[model samples]
Target: MNIEKARFNMIEQQIRPWNVLDKDILDMLIVVKRENYFPQDQKTLAFFDTELPLPDGSKAMSPKLEARIVQELGLKKQESVLLIGAASGYLAALLAHMSSHVTVLETSLALKELAEKNLAADGVRNVSVLLADGLSGQHTGSYDVIVIAGAVEAVPETLKKQLNVGGRLLAIVGRLPVMQAELITRSADAAYDTRSVFDTVVAAAPGAVPSSQFKF
Candidate 1:
C-alpha cells in the first residue's frame, strides 16, 4: 500500500465526513499506520468503512469511528487515559501517542492477548492492558481522560468516578441507530455534564450492563 496517500485519503474521506478536524489528530492517524496493527492476513481491510473481526466476540471499530473518538478526546500530553474495550490494542496504540499513560480494560481474554501482541508489535510502551469488564469500571488508577471504544446504554457511574476532577470521558451512549458520541466532563460539585459530539454506531461492549430501559 502507498501508505501516505492511503492515509491522506482515509482522513479526508472517511474521518472528515465523520467530523474529525484536528490537524494534529489527523496527522497522528497517518503516522500511526492502522494497517500495522491489524493481523497480517487482514491488513488490506484496515482502511475500510466497517468493523473488522477480532478475537472473542469482539470487533474493532471502523477506522472512521476510531478516528472520531480519538479526535474527540482532545488529549493532552500531560494526561493519563483509560480506554475501555481495548479490542486489538490498535486504538490503545493511538491513545499512547497522545497521552502520558494508558490503561486499557478488555472483557475478553482472547482479545486481551490480541491487544498485547498488537501493542507489542507497534512498540507501544506506556499502555497497561488488562482483562476486565468495562461496565464495572474496575481501575488500576485514576485518569485525566477516559476513552471508551464501544457504546453502552449509559456510562457506568464507576467509570465516571475514575475520572479526576475536571477530567473528561468520551463514550457512545443510547440505542442503536440513535446513538451519539458524548463527552462527559466532571464538575466542581462532583457531578457530570454530558453533550453529544456526533452520531455513530459500533458494537457495544461484550459485558456492558445495560440500563433498565434496555431490559424487556
Candidate 2:
C-alpha cells in the first residue's frame, strides 16, 4: 500500500468530511501515524472508517471520531489532561502532542502495558499510563481537560468533580444505536455547562455500564 496516499485519503475522505476542520488537528493526524498504534494484524485497518477491535474487547474510536474529539477539546500547550479508557494509547499519543502532560487510565493491565509500549515506541514522553478502572473515578489531582475515549450511558458526577474550574470534559453519552458527543465545561461556583457537539455511537468504555432503565 502507498502509505502516504492512504493517509491523505483518510484525512480528505474520512476525517475532514466529518467536520474536523481544524488545521492543526489535521496536520497532527498526518504527523502521528495511526498505524503505529495498531497491532500488526490490524495495521491495515488503521485509516478505515471503522472501530478497530482491541485485545481487551474494547474498540478504538474511528479516526474521524478521534479527530473530532480532539478538535472539540481545544487543548492548549500547558493544559494537563486525563484520558479514560486508554485502550492501545492512540488517543493518549495524540493528546500528548497537544498538552503539557497526559495521564491515561486503563482497566486492563495488559492493555496498560500495550499502551505504554506503543507510546514509548512512538517517543511520546508526556504521557503516563496507569492501570485503573475508568468508571471508578478514583484518582489524585484534577485536570484541565478530561476525555472519555468511549461512550457511556451518562457522565458520572464523580468524574465531573475531577475537572478544574474552567476545565472541559468530552464524552459520548447515551445508549446503543445513538449517542451524543458532548462537551461539558466547569465554571466558577462549581457550575457546569454542557453542549451537545454531535451525534454518533461507539462502544462503551470498559466498566462504564449503562444505567438500568425503569419500566412503567
Q: Which candidate number has the best TM-score?
A: 2
The local distance difference test score of each candidate is 0.83, 0.89
Window of ten residues with lowest summed lDDT in model 1:
206-215
For candidate 2, write residues 25-94 as lDDT tens digits: 9999999999999888888789899988887777788999989999999999999999998888889988
What TM-score against the true fold does each predicted structure earn?
0.92, 0.95
Q: Which residues of candidate 1, in runs, are more than 4 Å off?
A: 212-216
Candidate 1 lDDT, 23-112, residue by residue in tens: 888888978889987877878778888788886756888888887788887889999998888787888888899999998887788888
Overall local distance difference test of candidate 2: 0.89
- Point out where model 2 deviates above 4 Å: 213-216
The lDDT leader among the candidates is 2
Model 1 Cα shift for residue 174 (angstroms): 1.1
